[model samples]
Target: MRKWGPLVAVCLGTFMLLLDVTIVIVALPDIAGELGASLTGLQWVIDVYALVLAALLLGAGAAADVLGRRRVYAAGTALFTLASVGCGLAPGTGALVAMRGVQGLGAAAMFATTLSLLGAAYRGRDRSFALGMWGAVSGAAAALGPVLGGVLTQGLGWEWIFFMNVPVGAVAIWLTLNAVAPDGARGTRRLDLAGAAAFALFAGATTYAAVRAGEEGWTSGRTLAVFGVAAVALVLFGRAERRAVDPLLDLSLLRRGAFVTVLVAGLAYNAAAFGVMPYVSVWLQTVLGLSPVRAGLALLPLAAVSFVVAAAGGRLLHGAQARFVLGGGLLLIGGGTLGQAVLDADSGWASLSAGLAVSGVGVGLVSPALGGAALASVPARHSGMAGGAVNTFRQLGFALGIAVFGTVATSRMTDVLHDGGAARELAGGGAAALRGTVPDEVLRTAFASGLDGALTAAGVLGLVGGLAALAWVRSPGPEAETEAKAESERDRGDGVPAVGAGAPASPGGA
Candidate 1:
């Protein structure tokens, strides 16, 4: 019980953070309607959270190593809880977007430390099992997000979606404070302020550019300027890290093919899964005219299949080579996404369901195996950094996916509408304008064309990721496994206390 306490606390926090990623997606239309926000405003609401999270993750991980894992984790929970309240109470689109950024800050801190804390709490085969469980929680939470969001948004209101996080986060904070152990010693590493700033700018600028390009033309001055800024920042960030005493990101890790492969795999998996999800949700509601609850229920097969497959994949990680598992997973995602691309105006729920189930299984297999493999490839001491690296890429991939694929869908839709002689209607209003003014047949056909383009691009990305995994990822060698067992035995021999054993447990040993 003591050993598993920290895992539960961390998982709770992880569940809340990831749940937010997908939960808001289903509620976007409601938010837009109430706030009178444009498509750009809605995109920012989603993008800002991921953008902030990706930018700050590396710095947060370093902070965890220097400050304290439990301390950082608890602070994050408190901040996330507070931010959720603000989100629920927000009066306008801008306010909600700003608050979501704050929420991302808290999420970054919590995500940066959770895997490291888990690594510290368990060792050897126990470690593998614990991580598998952690992976399952992640898959399940993401899967549940849309359904839960639909239920809350439909029954209570969109505000309740954010409000619900408040009580759950409060409990997570309490559990973290009582159940997690303190770091034995803090490292005296210098925080790379310059490197952190540069990296943040680079990521933020790139995301801004992508989003702006979708709204304006790709060659617009604002988009080009931001892209230029991003390029400069990326170069500066590399230089700063190379010279820093204790860099936030270690460039040396990139030289390892396995590490780079896993990072790429993370990016690809998220690009196809998280990136494509928002549009799909919107299509269900806006195009098919399903209510929020029905749309959420319709997504059930994806979540259910993902949850089951992820658990199985985690168990398989103990013996299977990561390359095979990851590669196979990516292939499934590619095939699934390609299947979705075949949808036309005549397609129904059955077509969507079949594709979603395939993608879910792919995500399930890749999610845990990718994280576990990335962490294993790195030295134990740098576990926090490794986790951050993997997540950073995943978030960036998500941002890019949203930006690029969104552009494809929107542009394609516009082109279709224009070719059909509805350019004036589109110009008067965006998708909303089409709802009442345009003919149903015209609207459906245009939307389907846009979806086909987006899904095809996503499928190509997935296939590329699969190829990278097969080429670069490898399983742990025999010596590595032996060393891991030896380390576990040594920790036991030294009588290192299990998590929460030295500290007072929460009430009822939560």
Candidate 2:
């Protein structure tokens, strides 16, 4: 237990970072009302936080390698805590939004260094368990956010949501300094400032286009311009990464099977989770008319099941084949999400909870398994890079999932409402009422049809993701079993740096 204290602190930091993503959604109306934010401004409040975090992930990882992980981690905690206070105290929505973005920046720094620090602190079985625990805790945090946010928003105030982080973050920072060693890696690598800037701009533009496409329509000049800029910037960023000596991200890592597969899985997992959850919340509150607190409480089954399954999954890892475990998990997730397509006004909490439970179980199974697989594929020396790469893909997946899923949900809702005779009625009292408290009967009729369609679509996408993984990730038992036999007869090769021999000096692998 003592040996794992630092790991727990890092996991706590990770949990806090992920929790902020969805916690704010449950309080969106409150924030908007207090700050009088426009719809576009409200979108920015959410998207900007994700955008900044995604953009800085790779750069921050490299920074930790140079600056010393403990120093960077402590500074990140301080920045994040300070920003949270700023968010809580902000007089207006714009101020809160800006502070949230600052919080994201701090989160990026901490996220990049966390796993690397854990790797340094634990070894063998203990290290694997720590990584698995981290993954489990992160997922649970995402699931728990709405409940915690709703409780705070309803019982205390929205400001308490941000303020809640202060104590938790302080504890984490304190533990980080005293329990963890100074640096995870020794290096004199230069920061890829230009690459970082370009990547940030490109990611922001692309994500902006994806998110706004539903609201602004595909043909809107602003949306088109965002996509265009994103395209150009992405191309330029790729070129810059290829040419840089020490790039913020090592694109070459893309060639490895384990790394690439896990990255893909990471993307798919986020796409499913982000795409599905928002709609579920809407179904419960907007269609079913549950209060925010009630809606939040509805998620407890998923939370409880996910926590238990994730805990069990770590034990399964020692005996199971990675591919089999991961593929099966994805399949379950797909099955559960698809089941949500059956949700309607009449469906009770049992049905909803069951679907969420299945998805949660699936998520629990695959999340950490993929991370461990990715790290194992590389030599121990490259664990930091491998871990960072995995996280980058996960964040990118999250951004994409939210963007694409949000587009689908919004478009579907608009279409259904426009076609129905009650469209104007919905646009009037329903919209107005929806801006505040949602009543059950009103929510039931409003979301009954729309929720089914959205969940069905999300489930299909999830199932497709699962099937794709199944096809690509072979059954691990036979191949791995055979390899085990061959290994005893052969000498394990010495570690060779993945960087090719005689490769000329390029500027960034910092």
Candidate 3:
């Protein structure tokens, strides 16, 4: 009970953080209507959260080690709670976007410390089980986000979606304060400010360029300048990391084949699954004419199946080779996404449900396995950094996926409607413009065509991820497993119970 209490505290925060990702997706249409935001504005609302989180995660992890994991986690929880309040009370789109960025900063702190806290609390087989449980929570939270958001948006209001985080975050803070142990002392390692700055600049610049290209032309001067800035920042980041005594990100992790494979797999899963979810939600509402509640219910199959699959996948990671599981998962995702590409303006909910279920299963299989593989590939001491790295890649993939898919869909729709006056109105007025100006038949068909194109691209990316896993991911050797078990036995022999047994009580003894 004592050992598991901290896990619960961290998981609660994780669930809220991830839930915010998909929750806002279903609410975007409502937000756009109320705020009079353009399509580019919607993209920023989504992109900035991921962009900031991805940027700061590396630094957060390093800071946790140097300062204290519990301290960082507590501070993050407070910030997230306050920021959620700001989001709910935001006066306009700009205010909401800024608050979301603040929420991302808070989320980065909690996320980077989560796995490290678990590692500190548990060991050996118990650690594996804890991680699997963590994975399940992640999938379930994401799965529930849309439905919950939809229900809130339709029944209460869109603001309730952010408002709901307050109580949950409050509870999480209490649990964290009571359940987690305090750090023994601060480490002497210097914070890698240079590496952190360079990486953040590179990531933020690239994402900004992608979002700008989606609105302005790809070749626009502003976009080109941002791209150039991104390129130079990335080069500088690499140099800074190489020279740093304590790099924010250990570039050497890329040299390990397993780590690289896991990273790619993580990116692919997020790109195909989390990245495309918002657009799908929009399509359901605008093209299919489903209300927010109905649209959320429609996505239930994907979330439910993913939730179950992630739990099973985590347990499977104990005995099975991650390569097979990850490859198989990616294949499922590709097939599922490809199925969605077949959707047409006249298609019913049955087709969408089937495709979503398949993809959810794939996501389930990938989530836990990818996390486990990334942690296992790195040295034990580097687990916090490894966790941050994996999440950074996943979030970056999410940002890129949203930018690319949104651009494709919007551009294709514009091209189809180019001759119509409504096209110009859409460019300026956003989705609200289509409500009365464009004919229903024309709007549906054009948007459907754009959706198909986007799905096709996402499907191809999923296939590539699967193939990469198959080619590169491998099982740890039997000797390594034996040594790990022996280490566990030695710990037990030294009067330490396995985690979840009679392990040491947390500091405050919650």
Candidate 4:
């Protein structure tokens, strides 16, 4: 029990935080219906958690290093539990979105610490075994989220999805306090509070602009104003990074072509892959009349194939170059997303299976390789930054993708329907609610058209990512590689964390 206790505790927090990413998908209709949420509100509910999680991860990771990993992990679990209860009891769309953002804050803290906690707890073979187990558990989140959410929503109501966490979090908190080791010594790195704040402001502003653009025209005064804020925040973030003693993002890493390519790949891989699933969940329930369980099951092909392909890739392609693997995977993701763009009014849910499976291959191929690829591209001293940057971009990709795709979908639906006002309602899983007033056939056509647009947008992003990767990314020369390994060992001896000094999360997703 002593030996395995830390692994179990860390996994509990990891699974809950990641599961909430997609678990909210299957319950969107219920949430929209019960809360009377607008399309924008619905988008906020989904995107805010991801946005905050991405923004805070780097900052939170540094905090864990300073304040102690177990200490931060325990506080995060407690906060997440309380916030989950808040979400379950939220009285309206606004309250729910606010609580979900709090959930993200808690999630970021927990995520930032989990792997580091493992690194501190285990050694040698046990470290390898523990990390492998942790990765396996993390992979299960993307596969099981929708299915578990479905069972909870249909059988127990949507609230149980959040409510279910209370017991698990309580147990995790207990274990973290009792079983995990104390910090050995505090590090010298000071918190880059300026960098963290500026980055958060930038991310939040940009996402708000994307969401608002879907409502007010892109050229509208309100939309343009928010965009102006985003631009300013981005500039501030850059300045802060430049001035920091220990920056959240190291600017020097951006000079390397391989490192830059990996960052782009992280953004494209997540945005193109999992960003469109929430809308699919909507169409399944509101348009197709499938039960939540059935809707979740329909999405299972992608997750299942991803799991199998990832396991196979790890074994068979262990020695393969990351460029070919990641590039090829992204190409497959593009192909799969484009294939699904064929959906029409007459198409059924089964039309998504082949495309989902293809994208799954891409997801599996790219996910496990991300950290290794990032680590190899930069100097050993920058490895921790690379790891955290990969996750930041990946989550940022999801948030931005959701915002952009939602806009594309609503715009396309408005085009098809020729009624701008109805587009928002229809996009927010309101088809069943609007049925008697609007013709069912029209609703179906508009929804299909909107989905086609969103999928096409995601597909194009994927293709660009693939081609960029193929053209530019390269493995280091033998000399550089050897030097990096030596430096990495020295860093270890000096008690520096190899990856995620700020953070690296499990990369698997919807």
Candidate 5:
């Protein structure tokens, strides 16, 4: 019971950190109006947070290993709390965006240290159970964010969405200080400044290109330039990784079949499920004429189904091999998302609810198991590194999901609403002004189709993921278990600190 408390504290922090990411999307309209933000500025509000977090995850994990996980974790929570306050008080878009970037840095710190702490606290079956619970909390937090955001935005204002984090962050900080144990102080390693900058540049340029392509045409010179920069940055990043003594991402990890397969499954699951969630809110409001609050209500069934299934699946995780659990879950997710492709303007509530439920169920089943499988393969000492790598890939998948699916949906929107010249320019003004002139049914039907098309692409991606999991994940057999046991025995003999000690510092302080 005592040990469980600390693990639960870290899990709570995980929930709050992740919840902040999705909670803002539904409130973007309100934020823009209140702050007088241009569309580009609003994009920065969303894009920069993710870009910074994704870029720094690896470095942050490495730092926690060297700098002391407890210190880093506490500092991150404090920073996030203070930054949230700054976000609420910011009078302009620029200040708000800057605060969000700071919040992302703090989140990166918190996220990078969590797995190591958990590994430090538990072992064997207890460790597995803790991880499963962590997955369940994350899933619940994700499902709850939009609904909570909608209610808050409508009732109070957009700023309250950020303000809401204050109490939660406070609790997380308090828990960490009392419950988590500090590791033996270790020396720092050399910071990989070049690798960090290169990765950020690559991700930022690519994301900018994707979002810009949605606003402008794909063929625009600006879009081409963005893509070119992304390509160059990626190439340079690869070169830096190869030459660095302590690479942020060890390319060799890709060769490990277990590691790579689970990572792929993680990426695939999020790509399909997350890509469509925000748009589901948009569809309910714009097409079905529901209010934001009502639109959020419509998603409750999906969340409920996912929550229930995820809890049950966590218990089953102890008895099952990850491949079967994850593969089956992906299959269901794919099936559910494919169902979206069949939706039309007149689709009944039962059908929509059923499809969403299926998706939720699939996600419930896979999210935990996939994450567990990935981290389980790495030595406990490498928990932070493994966690960072797993999460970075997942974030990349999420960003790509939104980018790619958003492109398809937006393109379809433009095609359906195509007017000769001047009329086409009118869509840029606002959907409200055009609402009166266009037939409501036609507009609804068009949006439904576009939404479905995006869902189809996501569904196909999930199916691809399922297939990859099946083909690539070699089932664990006696030989594998024997090898793992031998590895553990060898480590004990060599006097390496046990799995929960967290990683020791490299030769130099980074």
Candidate 6:
């Protein structure tokens, strides 16, 4: 108990953060119903959380290293808990979106420190065990969220999903304060708060552009204006980082082929793998008349397969080149998503089963390898920043993916129905509400076409990203050449066989 207590605390915090995200996926229709949220409102509900998380992750990690991991983790837990209360009590979409953005800030802080706290608490075999357990909890949290959310939403209310976080977070805080210890050392860099803000602006503006484009024409003045703002924010972010003494990210790393490849791979992997899921859930419940529980269950195969494959792949694929692994995995994801484009007007939930499972394999492969590849591609001094960068881009991908795909789904459906309002309603899973206004067969046909279009777009994105990663991913630095020379000299001196001669080195055999 003494040895494992800290792990429990970390697991609790991680579980809560991930669970909150997934539970909301299953509850979107319900939230839209109760709050009178439009399709755009629903998109923001998902996008804002990820946008904030991605924007603040780097700064949050730096704070944890400088301020003390235990303190930041505890404070983050408290903030997250309090924000969950606000979310639960929110009177409308505006209030709920605001609270959720706060929740993202807290999640970023808590998540940034979790592994560091564990590394400080354990060593050697215990470290591996702790990480494995952490992975298990994380996977279980994601797997359980939809089903548990369904039960709660069905039995209690959607608010219970947020309210449940109160007790869980309270316990996490108690454990953190009691069990976690101070770090052995601190990062010397100062915070890059300006960069964080600029990047946040960039992400927010980009999401707004995509969501707004769906309602107003893509070329509308408001959409174009926001896109211009996003581009400017991105430029300002780059400038700030280039000028900072200790930038949130060292912009110089972007010049490296390997590091940048890994970053894009991470982003594309997340977007293609998980972006369209909320819509899938909406379709199952709103169009097909599946209960929330059944809708949740429909998505379970992907999670289950990914978990199993990840567990087994960690050992089996260790020491392989990250380029091939990450690239191939992304290709598999693309292929799977492409396969799901088979959705026709007559298609059923079973039509998605094979594609989801295939994509799961890709998720399992890329999920672990992407981080390793990122860390391996950088100088030791920049490793922390690299980890934060990969994660930030990954979240950014999800945020953008949701908005872009929502636009695809909405636009295609609108083309079929020739009714923008009806398309938005259908996208939000309220198609049953429009039965009198639109024929059932017409609704199915338009939804099928829209979903198919979104899937094709995601698949093409993944394929393009995969091809780029494969082409550009080389060993990051001279580490491989240096290691080979040392091995050769050692063989002449002591005649020990070069055991890893052909592995072509990577992070944990990535």
Specify the highest-lDDT model's number: 4
Model 4 residue runs over 4 Å out of place are 491-510
Which tens-of-lDDT digit does each residue in 209-231 have in candidate 3? 98788767689999999999999
Q: List all candidate RMSDs to the true structure.
A: 4.7, 5.9, 4.8, 2.0, 4.7, 6.0
Model 2 lDDT on a 0 to 1 scale: 0.67
lDDT by residue for model 4 over 1-510, one digit each (tens)? 789999999888888988888788888999998999988998999899999999998898888778877788899999999999999999999999999999999998888777777767777788667766666556557656787888899999999999999999999999888888777776777888999999999899999999999999899999999999989988998999999888888888889898899889999988898788888889989998999999989888877887777666665776788788889989999999999998888888999999998998888888777766776687766666887788788889989998999999999999988887788889998897779888888888899999999999999999999988887777667876787767646545333342357333333332
Best by TM-score: 4
**Model 5 Cα lDDT, one tens digit per residue, 261-322:** 76777778777877666566656654565665666667676668777777777665565866
lDDT of each: 0.76, 0.67, 0.76, 0.83, 0.68, 0.78
Cα lDDT over the full model 4? 0.83
Instruction: Pick out the ten consecutive residues of candidate 5 with the lowest summed lDDT.
Output: 501-510
- Expressed as tens digits, the lDDT of each residue in 75-188 for candidate 1 is 988999899999999999999999999999998888777766776777678866766778888877777789999999999899999999888898788878777776675656
Clashes of 6: 2
Which model, 2 or 4, shows the larger TM-score?
4
What is candidate 2's lDDT per residue for 269-358, written digit by digit as tens?
Answer: 666755556556645554555767887888776667766777777766566756667667777777787776665557865677778888
Better of 1 and 4 by TM-score: 4
Winner on lDDT (1 vs 4): 4
Q: Please state the error at residue 294 of candidate 4 in Å.
A: 0.6
TM-score of 1: 0.91
| TM-score for each model | 0.91, 0.85, 0.91, 0.95, 0.87, 0.91
